[model samples]
Target: MNRRHLLTITAAALAAPRLCFAQDAWPSRPVTLLVPFAAGGSNDVVARFMAPVLEQKFGQSFIIDNRPGGGGSLGMGMVVRARPDAQTLLVSSASNHVFHPLVSGDVGYDVREVLVGVSMLTDVPTVLAANPGIGVNTVPELIAKIRATRGGFAFGSSGAGTSNHLAGELFRMRMDLDMTHVPYRGGGPALTDLVAGTIPIAFMNLPTVAPAAEDGRLKIIGVCTGERVSVRPNLPTVMEQGVPDFAVRSWTGLFAPRGTPQAIVDRLGTAVREALAAPPLVARLTALAAEPIVMTPAQTDAFVRQEYERWGPVVRSANISANG
Candidate 1:
C-alpha cells in the first residue's frame, strides 16, 4: 500500500476504539435522578428506593435531587433542557407527565415529546380518606353527609393537578357532590392536616395515609382503583361503593431526555425491572401500598401516552388548573 493510504488507515483504526469506549462508558460518572416533588412524596419514595440498586448495578453513584415547585413542572423543565446522556433522568409520575400538561397550558414543551420513558417503577393506589370526626366510614355515608350539609365541604390533596386532586375532582363530578379542592404543598402536609382534623376529607396516596388509617386517626372511605389493590384487598373500591366508573392510580417511572442513547436506556430499564422483581423490593413496595410494575422501555412509553390521553378529557371537563 502507498504510504499516504497506510497513514490514513492507521489513523482510522486508532480512532474507532475511542468512539466505542465513549458510547459504552455511559454512567461513567454519577447519575442524577431529579424528582419533581418534595422528598416525602410517593415519587421521592420510589426514587430513593431504586437509587441504591441502580448504583450497585451501574457501578456508579445514583443521586436523587429533589426540586419541588410549579406543581412539579419546575423540575420537569430542568430535565427537558438537560443533556440526553443518561447522566440526568427525571423521576416522573402521573401528576407531571399526564395531569400537569393537560391542566397547565404554558408548560413550554410537551412532556411526552421531551422526555423518553425508561421504565415504569410502581403504581400507587389513591384512597379517599376522612378524619375520624367526619362520622363517615363508607363512600355512601360520606356522600350522604356531604349532601346533608347545605354548605359545600373541602377535600385536600397533595397539590393542584396531582393525581389525587384529579381523583377528588372525578369523585366530585361523578357523585355530584359540592366539594372544593384544597391543595397543599405536598401529600405529607395534607395528610398531617387530615390526621389533625384540619381537613375533614382528603384523596391521597394509600402509602401516605395508610399509617394514619391503621392508627384510627383517619378512615379510608374507599380505594380509588377500579378493582381492589393487592396491598389492601379488603378495602372496597369507590366504584364498588356506588361511584360509577372511577379509577385513578398515581404511578412513578423513569424518563430520560429525548434522544438519550437506546443502549443506556435499555440498560437502565433492565436494571429497574430486575430490582422490582427481587423479593426484598417487592416486600418493601407492598408494605408501602405501592405495587411494583415492571414495564419495558417501549411499554413504559406506551403507558405514559395512554395516561396522557386518558386524563386529558377529565382535566378539560373539570376545568382543572395549576393555579387552583
Candidate 2:
C-alpha cells in the first residue's frame, strides 16, 4: 500500500475505540422517566423529587410523563414500545406488574419482554382496611367473616390490576376466601367510596390510607406486611397475628425497552441507588412514610417476575376479571 493510504488506515484504527466508547456510554441525551400515575401521586412525587439529582449526575434532563389509566398499564405500554437506547425509562412498581395482567388479559405487552431498567422506589408496606360495619376488628376476624360469607363482601381498589388490587387478592388467597373487588380510577375515588360504605373494605397504599385510619373514616385493622411500619408503630402486621410468610409490598420502579445496554441500566440504577442513600431524600421519604427501595436492575427484574407468577393463581381462583 502507498504510504499515504497506510497512514490514513492507521489513524482510523486509533479513533475507532474512542468512537465506540462514546456510543456505548449510554444516555447521550435527556431521559424520559414515565410515571404511569397521576401527577403529585406517590410515584410521581418521588420521580420529580429525584429528577434533579439524576440530571446533575447524568448530565441530562430526566423528564416525567404521567399516563394514568388501566392503572399503570398504559404508561408501561409506551415504555415497552420505545427504542432500547436508554433514552426512555418506565417508573414501574409492584402494582403495574402484579395486577394488570391478572385482572385483564390484554395489557398487550408481556412484562418479560420489557427489560427492567431500575427500581427507582418502593413503599415500606402495603395496607388493607375495612370501612367499618363489616364487624371485623382484625385480620383473622375479617378472614372468618369472608369464609362464612363465601367472599361476598365488596372491596375497592385503585384499579383492576394495581399493586393495591393484588395486595387484597393475595390476602384473600392466604385466607382461602373470595370477595368482590370494586376498581376505581385512582386511590382518591376508591377511598371516598370506601368511607361512604359503597365498598365495605379495600387494600390501598399506606400513605393514602393511613390518614383515614387515623381520622376514623376507616378502621385500621392490620398492615399487609410481616412487621409493623415504624411510622405507625401502633399498627400490627397481619403476619404478626396469624399468617406466616405472608407479605405483600407495593413498590414503584423504572423500566426500559428490552436490549437496552447494561451500561445504561447500570448507570440509571447506580444513580438511583446513590440518590436513595442520600440523607435528605431518606428523611423526606421517612416523613412521608414511604421507604426508599434501591435495587440492582437484575434484582428488580426478578422481584417483578416473581410477583407476576405468584399472583396468577390468586387472580384465577378469585375469578376476578376486567368485566367483573
Candidate 3:
C-alpha cells in the first residue's frame, strides 16, 4: 500500500481504542439522581435506597437531589436539559412522568420525547381508605353511603395531578358516583385530614396509610391493585369489591436523557435488577409496602408508554387540570 494509505489506516486503528475507552468510562464522576418531588416521598425513598447499591456497583457516588416545584415540572425540566452522559439521571414516578404530563398544559419537556426509561424500580399499590367516622368498612358500604348522601361525597388525594388523584377520578368515573376531589399538598397532609375526618374518604399510597389503618384511625376499604398485594393479602382489591378494571399503582423508575448511551442504560438496568433481588433490599421494600418490579430497559419503556396511554383518557374524561 501507499505510504499515505498505510499511515491513515494506522491512525484509524489507534483512535478506535481511545473511542472505546471513552465509551466504557461512563459516569467518570459522581452521578446525580434528580428527584422532581420533595424528599420523603416514594420516589425519594427509592432513590436513596438504590443510591448506595448503584455506587458500589459503579464505583462512583450516586447522589440524590430533590427539586420540588411546579408539580415536578421544575426538576423534570432540569433533567431534560441536562447532558446525556449518564452523569445526571432522573428518579421519577408515575405521578410526574405520566399523570402530570397528561393533565398539565406545558411541562416544558415532553417526557416521551426527552427522557428514556432505564429501569422500573418499584410499584406501590394505592388504597382507597376512609376515616373511621365514615362508618364504611368495604367498597360496597362506601358506595351505598355515597348514594345515600344527596349532597354528594368528597374524596381526598395527594395532589391534583398525582397518580392517587387520577385513581380517585377513575373510581368516580367507573362507579358513576357524584364525588368531588379534595387535593392536598401531599399524602401526609391528606392522611392527616382523613384521620381527622376533615374528609370522609381518600385514595392514598398503601404504605403511607398502612399505619393509620393498623391503628384503627382509618379504614382501608380496598387496595387499588387488580389483585391482592403480598404486603396486605387480607385486604381485597377494588375490582374484587365490584369495581371492574380498577387498578392504579404508584410506580418509581429510573430514566436518562434521550440521547444517553444504550450500553450505559442497559448497565444501569441490570444493576437495578440485581440490587432489587438482594434479600435485604427486598425485605426493606416489602416492609414499606412497595413491591420491587425489576424490568429491562425495553420493558420499562413499554410500561411507561402503556401508563401514559392508559391515564390520558381518564384525565380527559374527568376534566382534570393542573390548576385543580
Which regions of candidate 2 are displaced past 4 Å?
Answer: 1-30, 102-106, 130-153, 170-179, 192-200, 211-218, 239-246, 313-319
Top-down TM-score ranking: 1, 3, 2
TM-score of each prediction? 0.91, 0.77, 0.84
Which candidate would rank higher by TM-score, 1 or 3?
A: 1
After superposition, candidate 3 runs with Cα above 4 Å error = 1-19, 147-152, 195-198
lDDT: the better of candidates 2 and 3: 3
Local distance difference test values of all predictions, in order? 0.88, 0.76, 0.86
Tens-digit lDDT track of model 1 for 96-127: 78887788876898887889989999998999
List where candidate 1 sits over 4 angstroms from the true fold: 1-16
Q: List the residue pairs that clash in candidate 2.
A: 92-253, 93-251, 93-252, 95-163, 99-161, 151-178
Clashes of each: 0, 6, 0
lDDT of 1: 0.88
Instruction: Report the lDDT of model 2 for residue 194.
Output: 83
- Compose the digit string of candidate 3's lDDT tens values, residues 240-303: 9999878888888999999987888888889999999999999988887889998999999999
Residues 1-324, model 2: lDDT tens digits: 999999999999999887668656666778898887766456766678778888888787889888878877887788888888878788776677667776787787678765664764756467788888677789888887877875377778777777677677666666666777788766667778888888888887776666677788898788887788887788898888786667777777777789876776777788889989999888877766788878888888887777778878766776666644
User: Using TM-score as the measure, which candidate wins?
Assistant: 1
Clashes of 1: 0
